[model samples]
Target: MMRGFDSYASIVFFLIGIAFVWESRKISESSYGSNVGPDIFPMGLGAILVLLSIRLFYEAMKAPKGDSDGKTTPDYKRFLMIAGAAALYAYYLEDIGYVIGTFLFLLFCFQTIQRGKLVTSLVVSASFSYGVYYLFVQILEGTLPGFPSWLQ
Candidate 1:
């Protein structure tokens, strides 16, 4: 069951990655007065996604045969919660701003995946969200919502 699910998920992710890469190509390269291109992030993400999906497929294929006792069940509730968080993050990204939205989303996901370790989750989430924000806004000169107006 796990093997079948992994294979199917990997294929889906692979297609999504391909689509991302393809669509990114249509974006005009380089923002005005900036050396970094708008498409760089998406393209890089797409590439990473493709590579990881391939790896997932390999892992699924290499998994040893196991007895499929009907006792094991997939955690649909957890999956749905994470999916909803992801959707909200995407929908309100501009409104909530990148740093805040990403931090909250990542934190939620990390905690959902493994409960406890609040400090570690907070540190990692803060680091990733702020790090990416800085990379794009400061270094790359790409536009991303930094903070909501109320936070100013």
Candidate 2:
């Protein structure tokens, strides 16, 4: 079952990588005077993904069949929770402000994955959210939603 799943995943990822590489060709070959183009990164990443997927396929094919007949139950509840949180995060990111939305989403995900260690999860989530905001807005001179307009 694991082997079959891996094989399917590899095929899917391989196709996705091929699509990325094909679409990347639509971008301009170079930017300004620089020889390296914006498309290069995506093309290169796609090639890497293709190679990795091929490797996965090879490993899956070579794997010995196990005798264990019992199938493991998937954690669908956890998956649904994380998926819902991610959807909400994407929807509310701009409206709620990056820092607050990201922090809440990360905190929720962390707690959902592991119930205990509330303080640690809070600290890590807060640090990541604020750190990204500071790095992008203050340090890099890039704009991100800082706080909701009503707060200002």
Candidate 3:
């Protein structure tokens, strides 16, 4: 199963690399000089991805057969919880404002998922949210959504 997963991932990466390489050719090269063309970064990244995917594919092909059987499967419940939380965060982010939404999301993850104390989770979440807000909005002069109109 693990080898299968690796093989699938490698194939996906290989396809992505091909797409990037193809798309890079369409970018206008007029703005960038001869040496540093518009396609340079995409082409470089695509080449690297292709090479890494080939290496991963080869490794997966040569890996021991029993490794997959011995390894434990990932927890679906935890995956679902995290995904659900992320979806919820995206939905509520603009409405609640960045600080409040982020605080609530972190608190939910810490308390519900990580089984942390309510007070500790709340404090940590609030502190982290405030720090991020200060760094991005206040210090960097980046605009973030203010308190929702309904809340005002």
- TM-scores of all models? 0.84, 0.66, 0.54
What's the lDDT for candidate 1?
0.91
Model 3 residue 36 CA deviation (Å) reads: 25
lDDT of each: 0.91, 0.87, 0.81
Off by over 4 Å in 1: 1-3, 67-71
Relative to the unseen true structure, what is the C-alpha lDDT of residue 74 in candidate 2, on a scale of 0 to 100?
A: 76
Which lDDT tens digits does candidate 1 get at residues 33-117? 7778888989999999999999998988887777233448989999999999999999999999999999999999999999999
Candidate 2 has an lDDT of: 0.87
Q: Write the number of the candidate with greater TM-score, choosing between 2 and 3.
A: 2
What tens-digit string does per-residue lDDT give for candidate 2 at 1-152?
45667788899999999998999999998676444567877998899999999999898888778722236767899999999999999999889999999999999999999999999999999999999888766775556677999888
Question: Can you write out model 3's per-residue Cα lDDT over 15-99, one digit (the tens) per residue?
Answer: 9998998899998753422334566678889989999999999999898886572378877887788789989999988888988
Candidate 3 local lDDT, residue 77:
88
Q: Which stretches of candidate 2 lie over 4 Å from their true place?
A: 21-70
| Best candidate, lDDT | 1
Estimate candidate 1's RMSD in Å: 2.7
Residue-pair clashes per candidate: 0, 0, 0
lDDT of 3 at 60: 91
Leading candidate by TM-score: 1
